[model samples]
Target: MTETTPFGIDLELDETVAEGHYSNLAIISHSTSEFIIDFAAVLPGVQKARVKSRIILTPEHAKRLLRSLQENIVRYESNVGKIVIPVPSSPGDTGPKMGQA
Candidate 1:
């Protein structure tokens, strides 16, 4: 049986999913009832980018996730230091990797 947590239930991570996907970019689209997030990798100078993973969440769940991420980011910065986001050198430059436009 899966154990229960104060916030929710325990999650089981399979070997395949535990490895995780490497996503350099994320594309998000939403409708009236749900939101879709597509994770992808964009290599520098490459014209095409492939979507690695897609996750669909309800509007309420999405908002909860946003808050969770915000809290985690604050804690992470407090422990490791502020994350420096790099600015692209050119207008069209999309950083180290330039995936699908």
Candidate 2:
């Protein structure tokens, strides 16, 4: 079943998609017109992490997503306290690097 939101877009979520995937890392790459984001899960002692989901968005949509995330994060921190990101322990341990195409 699909429902129409106030924006007049019909949205549908199947059972499988509703369960969702867990991702600890995201790799972002972009070209002039589009952006590609790969979501992955990395486990301890695992040598390699596989990309579980890949989302491709146009540059305009990607910018919208960035703004939406910034707004939501402000609201989230207001209620749940500030979210902290830990610095890398070593220079070589920098996490999640973005790539260009």
TM-score of each: 0.83, 0.83
lDDT of 2 by residue, 7-28 (tens): 9999997888878999888888
Clashing pairs in 1: none
Clashes of each: 0, 0
lDDT of 1 by residue, 24-57 (tens): 8888888999988888887877989899998899
Q: Tell me how many residue pairs clash in candidate 2.
A: 0
- Which regions of candidate 1 are displaced past 4 Å? 1-8, 96-101
> Please, what's the RMSD in Å of model 2?
2.7
Candidate 2 Cα errors over 4 Å, as ranges: 1-6, 90-101
